[model samples]
Target: MLTLTENAAIAVKAVVAGTPDVQAAGIRIRGAEAPTAGFELTLAPQPEPADAVVEADGARVFLDSTAQAALDDQVLDAQMNEDGSVRFALAAQA
Candidate 1:
């Protein structure tokens, strides 16, 4: 299963709060066509059918089966760059 770090959850929540009509919104993750390609992440108004729902730190995340499989045992983390931009990273569980 995929998991979000505290900072990632906080960031996701903040993003959802800023969007209109996003009370039901959550972070959605999908796998790319190529195995080596990076995953896609966005705020979705709702979960799609058969999506794997994961919750942490009062935030929700929805992932399709393929994404769930690809992110298995992975951790989602967020970091702030020196230029005041936020970057997300995926890493193996410790």
Candidate 2:
């Protein structure tokens, strides 16, 4: 299963907290059609029927089946950008 780093979970929670309409929103990972293709991430108000949900540190993440397979051993991390913005990155589990 995909996992989020502590900072990533904190960042996700902060984003959801700022969006009143998305109080119960979780990070959604939209999988690509092909194995070699890239995926996308967004804040979703709810999980899809086929989503694989992972929750930790008071934050939840919803992943499509393809994303679950692709990111089975991956980790989500957050880093500070040059402009002091937060950037999310996916890394292979070591």
Candidate 3:
């Protein structure tokens, strides 16, 4: 299963907090044609029926089928950009 780093959890929680109406909001990751090619991230009110839910440190992340498999042994991390935006990155789990 995929794991989220402390910073990633914090960042995800912060992002979800912005949506006052959606208490269960989470970041959803979806893979394109190739999982290694790239991933698309979006804020969702909740996880889909078939999504793999990963929760840590009060933060939730929903991964589609492809994303779930692709990130199975990965660690999710977050970085703050100069413009005050969060950038998500994936790294091999040690």
Candidate 4:
């Protein structure tokens, strides 16, 4: 399973909180195939039926099948940018 670092959880919660009228919202990850294979992230109101839900420090993240498999042994991290944007990164679990 994928794990979220403290910073990542805080960043995810901040993002979900900033979205208006959204209940149980979280960051959703799915496999993407644009040019090169990768993953896409978005805010989702709820997890999909087949999605894998990962929560840490009250932050939620929904991952699709492909993403779940790809990130199974990974850790999610986040960093705040100068312009108040959040940047997410993935790394192998230590």
Question: Which candidate leads in TM-score?
Answer: 3
Instruction: Give lDDT: candidate 4, residue 30.
Output: 97
**TM-score, model 2 to reference:** 0.84
lDDT of each: 0.83, 0.85, 0.91, 0.91
Q: What is the lDDT of residue 29 in candidate 1?
A: 89
Clash count per candidate: 0, 0, 0, 0
> Runs in model 3 with CA error above 4 Å?
none
Predicted candidate 4 versus true structure: per-residue lDDT over 1-94, tens digit per residue = 9999999999999899976644578999998755268899999988999999999998999999989988999999999887889999999999
Question: Could you list the CA RMSD of all candidates, in the order they appear?
Answer: 1.8, 1.9, 1.4, 1.9
**What is residue 34's positional error in candidate 4, in angstroms?**
7.8
Please write out the lDDT profile of model 3 over residues 1-94, one tens digit for every residue: 9999999998998889878655588999998996458999999989999999999988999999999988899999998777879988889999
User: How far is 14's C-alpha from truth in model 3 (Å)?
Assistant: 1.0
TM-score (all chains, Cα) for each model: 0.86, 0.84, 0.91, 0.90
What local lDDT score does residue 31 receive in model 4, on the 0 to 100 scale? Answer: 83
Model 1 spans with C-alpha error above 4 angstroms: 81-84
RMSD after Cα superposition, model 4: 1.9
* Cα TM-score of candidate 1: 0.86
Candidate 1 residue-wise lDDT, 1-94, digit = tens:
8889998887777767766666678888888888888788888988899989988877888998889999899998888666755688889999
What clash pairs does model 4 have?
none
